[model samples]
Target: MKLMLKYLKRYPKLILLNILGIFSFVAVQLGIPTVMAWMIDNGIGNSDIAYIKKMGGIMLIVCVLGGAGTILLTYASSRISTNMIRDIRNDVFIQSQNFSHTEYNKFGVSSMITRTTNDAFQLMLFSNMLFRTALLAPVMIFISVFMTIKTSVSLSLVIGGSFPFIVAGVIIIAKLTNPLSKKQQKGMDQLNRISRENLTGVRVIRAFRKSEYESERFAETNDNYASNSKKLFKIMSFTQPAFFFLLHLAMMAVFWISSLMIDKGTLQVGQLVAFLEYQFHAMFSIMLFSMVFVMYPRAQVSANRIQELLDEEPLVKTPTNGITAENKGVVEFDHVTFQYPDGELPVIKDVSFTANKGETVAFIGSTGSGKSTLINLIPRFYDVTSGSIKIDGVDTQNYDLKALRQKIGFIPQKAFLFKGTIEDNLRFGNPNATPEEINHAIEVAQAKEFIENKPKKLQEYISEGAKNVSGGQKQRISIARALVRKPEIYIFDDSFSALDYKTDATLRAALKKETKESIVFIVAQRISTIMNADKIIVLNEGEVVGMGTHKELLKSCNIYYEIADSQLTKEELER
Candidate 1:
């Protein structure tokens, strides 16, 4: 909350106006019982109808001013609160884009989404309410108690004795409900994760007939969230009854004592009437404090959650004077060893390889053999666990991320497109790309056919993640998006898996001419996909067992030879 309060510094004038408004409201509220005390004890005691009418007029005007102040403060508080929340939400989202891969993975995707949305919203609720009511509540409560004690200290005993119970109730309920509310937010994360996963892979779940299992998983998460919510509310529910009961009991005691004092000729009936209104004021103030009690704990937890993400420092940083290069493509992996974070050993052990400018290098490995892992390291996405990767004879780590990524183009196995027109998605690779450049890239990636067939051609709209298009079409558009940039090095991580054999052959053939001056690396499962490359690597059990042309590997390496034999037909092998 302190972190959030820093934003209020931007709105000092507005905050002051809101404070003035709250003060005005509390002033009129406090004056109400005070004026009543005078009307009963002074005006009615003398039977001065004119004096009573005058006090009544003043009270009515004070009430109008209070109502006006209420509107002003509520409006001011809402505007400030909404703007502050917008700033916070923007910062959270922008910072997320800069988070290191490890940092992002640490919290998990679902948790980040939950924090950005639900947790931030909780903080907003408390901020809005506190701005409007928390400050005024104390003003009314303090002054009311002071007035009651000044009138008669003996009657003050009623407030002194029972207000403690209300405070205690708030404390106990806050302590119990707070942790449960935090747990509920975590459960909400799991629920969001299940929903997102199902939506993203709806086809696969349906194809495999796993709807029942997915439904069970979703229900478990929903029930957990519901149970946590119920626990928090059950505790929070104590405030209302406990407060009103304490107030009424205290009021009863005050009435009995006031009657005795009046009979004893020590207190007046009008004074007693005014004293009851002050008691009501004190009780309502406690109610407002109860609300603050309920809101603060939830906000504190939300603030903590948001702070964790903001405080996270990305593990990777560019050097003070990072290099920026303009050389032709030259990628080298020198004695590179790496592993997934939880793996027992390095998945790519003591691997050394180089691909010169304009050369094509392919990694051919079976599943779990670390081909994709090697491809990922070149761009510094998942950095090498040990050893160095270089581009243009300079260590990639020494290049600012902007300079390193700008020169390399990537096409992943799973194609993703944003919600926009085809032209908009294509322009993401190079926003300055001309119409001619976009059209040419589309032709090269074999996406032109479908794009041209659309009603709006390049302007055709795509739904989120390109759900409007087929898998192969989306892959082609993704490739076109990369090609439009004309990057120095293009890495295709099995980007052709969905294409038919004929399309795959055509795509590779087109690449030979269009990408002749650009280095190309591909990770492939099919022998035919990487067969025509200048050089190929075969990784197995975290080591490179073969590095040669297709014919040379067939002659020399058992694993590579077996792969080629198993994946190719006899007649094709003879050819």
Candidate 2:
């Protein structure tokens, strides 16, 4: 409720309107009973036709007013609930935008989606009930109980006697459903995760002939979700009938006891009729309150899930009033060390290097040697565990995150393209890039031939996940995207692994001229890819074992020599 009120308070006028509607509705409900009793005792008993007509007309007017009030209440509740949910979803999305890989791993992608969408929807349903029925229930109960006793204190005990049973049942239902609600939500998360994995990894599943295994995994999760839902629905289904049974018993007792009083000549027939009306309203109000109680556990569960997401503070936070750099060309790693949040050992340890303007520095190593991790530090994707990384002689942490990233163009090993035209994806790197800059980037990345072959060329639409293009095409487009940025530093994390050797050589030669004034870093496995680099750094188990040019490293660095020996011919190695 604390989380709910934070958003509910934004619309004060709607709250006031809802309140007005509740009062009007309650007034009509209570007043009609009194008017009926008056007609029975004074008009019908005395044969006064005019009084009957007058009272009938008044009841009609009150009913019309009550209908208007119900309409107003519904409108207010709907507007407030929908708007509140919209605002909450927006905040969840904005908060997620600031999350790093650490946070993403903390809450899986499927769980986050459930929180933003399903959990928020639960809150909306609860809020709508809160504004419509929850508010009116209390007011109705208080007034109805007062009128019931005023009509006959002895008869009111029937209603009062049934109250404790309803309260006890509501409490028991709440307790039973609380744990089940939690399990139900978790089951939903697992179901979504399996479905997401199956859809995204369909190709791998088919290639490995694991389609049956994948199907079984998904079916198991779906069954768990369905079982929890079935259990929850069973409990709720039992509640309504149980409450009605108690209501009927109370009504039977009221009728039996009131008949005895009427025979004793102490209770008039009209008063007896009025008493029953109040009893029904009071008992019905309790049922409404019980519904709110039963639904509270599920809504509270959803609320906690949503609040957990909003409460999470990202491990990497942007500093206020961050420093700005004068030049963005030079890059330096001063004894940087980094460990994963859950790892037992550091992935990159005490590594240091510097690349001046107009230098091409390459990194080569066996898999899992921190090649990608080292480059990720430059863009502050993960901050160093101990030492500071400086760009243009300024500590990376000191610079504003956006300002720091704007200085470098980074392309990952696995190329990814959004669903859009070729030009749209290219413009993502630099939104204001000119046609001339785009054409130059395509030529340098060696993407011109394939793109021009397409009927629409730049306007050609790329499907989701770039499924329409080949591996090499995606890599070139990714490279061209970075080239369009024309930043001071370019870091390609094995971005050329998809291309043939000839294309790789041609692209690198073109890059030498295009990026002569900028700092460049490349991580590759092939010896020929980095043999022409100005400097090459050899890594082993996250440590920099060798730092020198290809020829120099072949003499001093055993790790470099072995890697080059594996991929390079005797003639290429000597060259």
Candidate 3:
């Protein structure tokens, strides 16, 4: 809630205007009861028709002015509240984006989504209602009290005694709802996580024939969410009728007590009638106050969640006096080791390697062998656990990330394409890349034929993630995207997996000529892909088992010999 209030300060002027509107609105609303009191006491009770008509007209005019105030302020406050939400939403996104890999993993994907959407929405709801009802309620309540006391001391007792009941009601309901609202937010995150998993892995679930199991998992989370919601509502249900019944009872008490005085000739008929109207105003004010309190608990839970994300500082940071640029195409890892944020064991350990300018270094290992992790270290995607990785003799930690990453081209195993044309996706690599530059990149990636054959060529529209294209085509586009920049170091992390043996052979052959000036690093499982490379590294169990040429390793390390023998014939492997 404190964080939310800080964001509200951005629209200080608008908020001040809104407060003024609420003040005027409450003044007019309070005036109505006063006019009614005057009409009933001085005009109707005395049987003065002219006074009654005049008071009625004044009351009607105040009601109209109050209505106008309500509408104008509602529109303005909504704009302020909505714009505030937009700012918060943008800030959360920027904060999350700035978080390091370590910090991001701590929150997880689904919880982050919940914070950005559900939590921000809760704050929006609270602020929107607070501007409209919060200010007016207390002011009207105070005014009603003062007006009743002026009418008479006995009538003030009629209204003020009921204050304790509504106050106690609000406090009790707020306490019960605070915990339930927190639980509700957690349950929502779990439900969102379940749904996201089901959508993304729908094929896997069906393939494994585990639909029933997944359905049960979803049902368990869904039921928990529904049950929690019902429980909170049950608690919340106490406040409203409890408020109405208590407040109306106070009004009835005013009527009851004032009636006796009227019969005794101590109070006039119009005075009793006026007292009844002020009693209703007092009750309505408390009802409005109770409504705002109800939203507070839910908003507080939301605010805390958002604050956690915003306050997280990225683990990776630029040094205070860090240099921005470095020599390109030379990478060295000295005793590098790494582990995922939550992993029990190290993924890569004590790995030492170097790839100099115009050299090709290939990492060949089985699945879970840390081949991709080794490549990821060069670009500083995940900071190394213990050792230093340097580019051009400068420690990676000392170089600004923007300058460090610009010299490297990275393509992940799973390709990602944004919503745009083939040209636009490629141009993402180099925004100022020319049309001829685009075609040359496509040719280098071996995607020229297919792209040229497209109905709209580079103008061919693509949906999000490029679902409109085939798997192999998406892979080529990703390659073309990376190739357009012609970075000093080109990292292909199992990039040739999707292409057939023939296409993979041709692509690698073309890359040799095109990438002569670039230091190429390839992580592949296929023996033929890295067989002719300048060097080959074999990783197993987080350690470098062997580092040598293909033939050199086949004649040396047993692990390398066994891997080569299993994939290729012993006669061919030995040769």
Candidate 4:
């Protein structure tokens, strides 16, 4: 909750203006009852028509002033609350962008989305209420109580006597609902996660004929959320009615007690009526304060959630004073080891290798041999747990992250494209890339032919995630996007798997010539894809078992020979 005060401080002028507006509103409201009391006693009781008319006009003017003040108060609250929420939402999103892969996995995508959207919205509602009603409630109560004391000290006791009970009830209700609110928030995250999974994997669910199972899973989460909400609302339902009952009881007591004083001629009729009005105002103000207790516990939960994300320290820290190297593409992994945070064993162990300019270094192994993990370390996606990774004679950790990443063009195992034109996607790598450069990259990736067939060519619309395109087409476009950068190093993590053998062969042939000045690292499952590389690395489990050219490895490495034997003919293997 303290985290929110920083944003609130941004609008000092608005806060002052809102306070003034609320003061006027409460003053006018409290003044009207006093005016009516005077009219009833001095005007009607004394048989003076001019006094009645004069007081009536003053009451009408006070009503108009109160209405205007209410409008100002509402405007100020709306502007301040909405702007604060917008700033907070932006800050949360920006912080999430800085999160490393480890932090991302820790929170999960669905939970982050819920925090950014639903949780922020909850804070907005609470802020609006705080500015509009909660702050005014206390001030109104104090003024109304003061007026009651001035009118008749005896009637003031009614308000003071009822205060303690209302305070105790609010405290108890808040404590009861606080834990339930946290549970409700967690349930919402689960519901969102399941819904996102179902939407993204709808085709898989249909293919497996498990829609009923998915429905049941969704229903279970939905029911849990519904149950928590019901309990919280049921508790909150007691608040308004209970407060109203207390107010009515106090009003009745005041009437009964004040009548005795009026008959004895100790308290005037006008003073008695004014005192009753003040008592009502004071009790109603307390009721408004109670409303805050109902909504605030839930919003406090949301604020804490947002604060947790902001406070999270990323596992991979960016250097404050980082360096860069000007050397041509040269990558080295020296005694590298990596283990997942929750895994029992290291995924890659004591691995050492290097790839230099104009070289095509390839890695091949059985699935889960740390092929993708090895490449990921080069860009500092997950820093090596043990050893150092260097680029152009400088350790990767020493280089500024942006400068280091700009030197490499990496294509992940899965290709993703934003919803935009082909040209927009290509420009993502290098915004200043010329048309000629984009065309050259498209041709090298073997995508120019298909792109030309489209009526809009480079301007054609691509759907979100590039779902409208085939896997092979998306892969080619991803490759082209990377190429547009003309980076010093190119990494393809099984990027050719979706392409047909002929297209893969042609793309590789074109890349050989196109990337002659740059270093390239390829992770592939197919033996043919990597057989003709400058050097080949063979990994088994987490260890590298072989390192040599195809022929050299076949002669010296048993694992390489077995892998080759399964994928190549005897004559092909000998060649």
Largest TM-score belongs to which candidate?
A: 4
lDDT for every model? 0.87, 0.92, 0.85, 0.92
Which residue pairs of candidate 2 clash? none
Question: By lDDT, is 3 or 4 better?
Answer: 4
Residue-level lDDT tens digits of model 2 in 489-529: 99999999999999999999999999999999999999888
TM-score of each model, paired residue for residue? 0.93, 0.95, 0.94, 0.96
Question: Considering only N, C-alpha and C atoms within 3 Å, which residue pairs clash in candidate 4?
Answer: none
Clashing pairs in 3: 40-270
| For model 3, the run of ten residues with the poorest summed lDDT | 270-279
**Candidate 1 local lDDT, 201-221, one digit each (tens):** 999999999999999989988
User: 478-573, model 4: which lDDT tens digit per residue?
Assistant: 999999999999999999999999999999999999899999999999988998899999998989999999999999999889999998999998
Model 2 gets an lDDT of 0.92
Q: After superposition, how far is residue 354 of candidate 1 from its true place, in Å?
A: 1.8
Q: In lDDT terms, how accurate is model 3?
A: 0.85
Which residue runs of candidate 4 sit more than 4 Å off their true CA positions?
Answer: 47-49
Candidate 2 error regions (>4 Å): 268-270
Count of backbone collisions within predicted model 4: 0
